[model samples]
Target: MGPVSSRKQSIVFIGGGPGGYESALVAAQLGADVTVVDRDGLGGAAVLTDCVPSKALIATSDFMSRFKAAGRLGVGFEGTGDDQHAEAHLSAVNRRILTLAKAQSRDIQAQVESVGGRVIQGTGRISGPREVEVTPDDGEARTLKADMVLVSVGCTPRVLPSAMPDGERILTWQQIYDLQELPEHLIVVGSGVTGAELAHAYLGLGCEVTLVSSRDRVLPGEDADAATVIENVFRRRGMKVLNRSRASGARRDGDGVVVSLEDGREVHGSHVLLAVGGIPQTSGLGLEEAGVEVNDGGYIQVDRVSRTAAPGIYAAGDCTGILPLASVAAMQGRTAVAHFLGDHVAPLNLRGVCANIFTDPEIATVGYSQADIESGKADGRIVTLPLSTNPRAKMRNINDGFVKLFARPGSNTVIGGVVVAPQASEMIYPIGVAVQNRLTAEQLASTFSVYPSMSGSIGEAARRLHSLES
Candidate 1:
């Protein structure tokens, strides 16, 4: 190591997304001079168009869906007979979603500036290993001297040449918020997390939804049991799911869209929402010139500490192709800053990371999965308890979903867990904690969870794992 510089370190972030803004906060707090240059507004696509807006729309859909259960709970709409229906005003909902997203973006910018970090609205590109050139919308270009540069430009919705978005009928998830009316018949192409989530949201919003999945089932990357439950629920709710259908292209019809399948079949719909996937925003960033290595898929290659191949250059978030969750990006950002500052930091343990899909009967998982055990990738014991058996679930009329736990075979230490329930995202936290701390199944079972709560099922599942071990 060379002699330590007496001056404070200067850090430049090339994006304003979760990774950049989050790490800027940490770097500023550590007494480093920080600057964040971004072309999009502060919170980036994840906040402005993707994650926040979609979730806000989903919240409205979920709330509207609850009205269906009111009659079972002895609630009445007085004079509406037994047919009470809730309507989602698309214009109003879209407005609210945009407002919330913009507000959050402003808040994130404020938080960064409050911590002594400078936020610049500009397009950033690496001019050198330690230099970032920024071009603002209306100002002259400027170069920033950075002791450390973090590239986290995030990703964009992938578009296929065969099917193009017109922003009116054919659309990407980011463009849907601009719609003034709900789609009469929405055909969603793709069945991954984003596709499943938006398809269900539209279905809940009373649109005739047709989910097109190329795989044998939806959510192929998630827990199999959870995907089955969601698929069943989608079908039960009148949404049409076409499995093993590969969309070749989509074209405009008279007043609707026609999606052509590879099998010489066509599905007609009022609109088509393409949720195929996202491409990392790594191009045009001069990564090659900076000596930062980008994989063939355009993802920045980084270690667990978020270090790129080039010295003093780090990458995080979707650009890094790590877990695409916002939480994971935030953690990566913090970890990068900590490591750069020579502060105590733990290398990111992906196995302990928790991921959640935002949908009705949401699926959440932490640590190893059942597939890992079955595939002989891990040694564990498993137990599953259905939500139908939980008193709270019964009282709430939630008939579907379950809690599954995994523990070490001999030691009984909690290794992982999967939750398929309404708000499973919230329920997975404790299991995440257990897995992170290597807590035993007995310890998790011994903890006091409120009786008649959905969380109680987690404890029950843990208790049952002990029996499996014996």
Candidate 2:
């Protein structure tokens, strides 16, 4: 920390994603001279290609899924059988996704500019500890002096040498929106969040989907029980899930593609989507020259407050390898700005952060997990209640999900929870609040939840935990 300057502190942000733009707004609002340098449009990859567009496609897929289930709810079309089958128009969906993403980018840019923050559409690099060099697409390169620099360049889809995406038969998640027609038989490689999500979305859209996973189970990084539920749902919905299968490579074969497994087996599909993972975009940013340290995987090293080792330089978002979610990025960005400005700021509490998978039966979790308790990392008791018992779930004919809660053994304080349902993302917030505030299970159970709603299961689980403690 340095002397408090009387004048407005100058801040330069490299990259215009959630981490960059969100911090720019905060820094500007705090009377700092803020400038954001970015190559792509505002909103970065999350808004433009990954999160926003993917979710938009999922929303459409979810609607189609619900429509397909109408016949079970005593709803029928004029014609019977195949005549009533619904189809997803990929062209229209892709067009809408791009349109929505661009509009959001423009909105973010407008908001930043309206707040008196400057945005340069260019590539930004840290030239020194407090200097940024920006090269615009249509203009000459220029250098800007700043009191602080924030690096939030984000990350890119990690490409494997053997299964390189051709943006045609073989595609990365980012290249999926360019598709003019739906894949006939889609082979989704990797069973991580992105792979599981897109695979489920395509399956709901009436495409033949085969999910290939190297791990024994899908969503290997998430809660085990939640993953099992999703896997069961995938199998029930007619998806071919190949576990313990690693894809060696993929190549175009006539009108379709062939994916080779390490076991000398091959799977053919109309298209293959590589959702393997992402690599941090920390290269060519002059980080080493600026004395900013990066890890072996090329992710910028940052403290909980997003400070880099070099003075006046901070890093956040995927580039920091903290958490890849947009919400986490925004929080990290704000924290970095506040810490730099000498304002009140709390170090990031990752345990309280909520994570969600947007499958048909979404899986959302917050705080300590069952794995934590079993591994002796956390001390807590657990109670799980199936959604099949929930009135709302019964009405909706959803039978494949549950709500699990964790509480301290002695105090009965709510430590964590997991929700697997239609809108688990939205439902996880209350549990998140309980975890963040360290509320007791009794407190949570006493809180009012809507009658005949899926959230009631959360209350029931909490009550059960409280009773066991008593």
Candidate 3:
């Protein structure tokens, strides 16, 4: 007599990006069998094309920004800031950095495989509510039946017909690596965080950079005051920021591109980097056939816990079209698995998610915003402390930016905050913890910060809120 085969429920995760791979690792640790499929290698677009590579380039720019501003900090420079002949100017080793960034991506792949989960290199789809079909690179077609399936397909750079990336004259953030030499004049289209960060990076790298913003200020999606500080700093750095300017298209003229703006204005440059946003990769994945709902933008609709309309299928990351950040993707993925496991779980809270734009005097915001509070969308009070007034600012030669906190009118609990200054990304973490843990202003104020540190401004802001409470 033959023994009967027993079947155990398996979790099939499609799309091997941050959302898929990270959760796959977590789910496996929780004693669930997981399989991840992707068109590219593991770690997905975030590691291969976006966050990791862009941050590597930004690191070079960060150092350069410091060198350019070093003179103001009482550091000696042999010549004028504009003097090309001067050896004391900011420089870059883009080639070395790009090489190192790629190596780091490979290392991420190694970590993903160590968790005893399977990552199949291929495209995948939801064949049915709880079924996944994978088209592997080896011409093998396999179907995976699972108790739950997670869709984390991620996204791709949005390209306009007018300025197709030629990988030389005009380029997307991903294609910028194809560049052999640093651009002499890089005209960046789009003034959002992506546009502003790259424009600032290129300018710091000694490129004559022009930032094109359709709005009156940079970082239109962020706090107005924060954007204003960055815009002012950009102008002061001679970045040639074109406000209220819209780029119509880009065309190759010989070896360069002349970016045509809406006002018949022409800006010629050695290269053009398109900092426009990305489109989620949801099409042709059999999503329509699987009874999953996709919005006008092609984003899959998911519930608070990342459950799609289809009972057994869930989606996360940029594929869900939530606010785009790698950290958010990871959280959504973990939430989806927790929800599927039938455990006590909470819906993902993006309010505590910190967003940073890596410009000189970086802008970081977390939780609720003053703009929302003032607009009546939220009810809260605000307290702002400019960095210039802080003793640390004077010692560090910091002349721009501030820390602004928002709290409920009566409860005085911090609802949200924004930091616009050097290393604002790092300073916003404590506020993020406070907001996430539902801590009150009094609780945050009680924490002591070292004197002569920028973080003291955060504690000071919390202390002022106590005065308002009294």
Best by lDDT: 2
Clashes of 1: 0
Q: How close is candidate 1 to the true structure, as a TM-score?
A: 0.98
Q: Candidate 1, overall lDDT?
A: 0.92
What is candidate 3's lDDT per residue for 387-424, written digit by digit as tens? 99899889888899999999887899899999988888
- Score candidate 2 by TM-score against the native: 0.98
Off by over 4 Å in 2: 1-4, 79-82
Stretches > 4 Å off in candidate 1: 1-6, 80-84
Write down the lDDT of every candidate, Cα atoms only. Answer: 0.92, 0.93, 0.83
Q: What residue runs in model 3 are displaced by over 4 Å at the alpha carbon?
A: 1-8, 77-92
Task: Give the CA lDDT, 0 to 100, for residue 290 in model 2.
Answer: 86
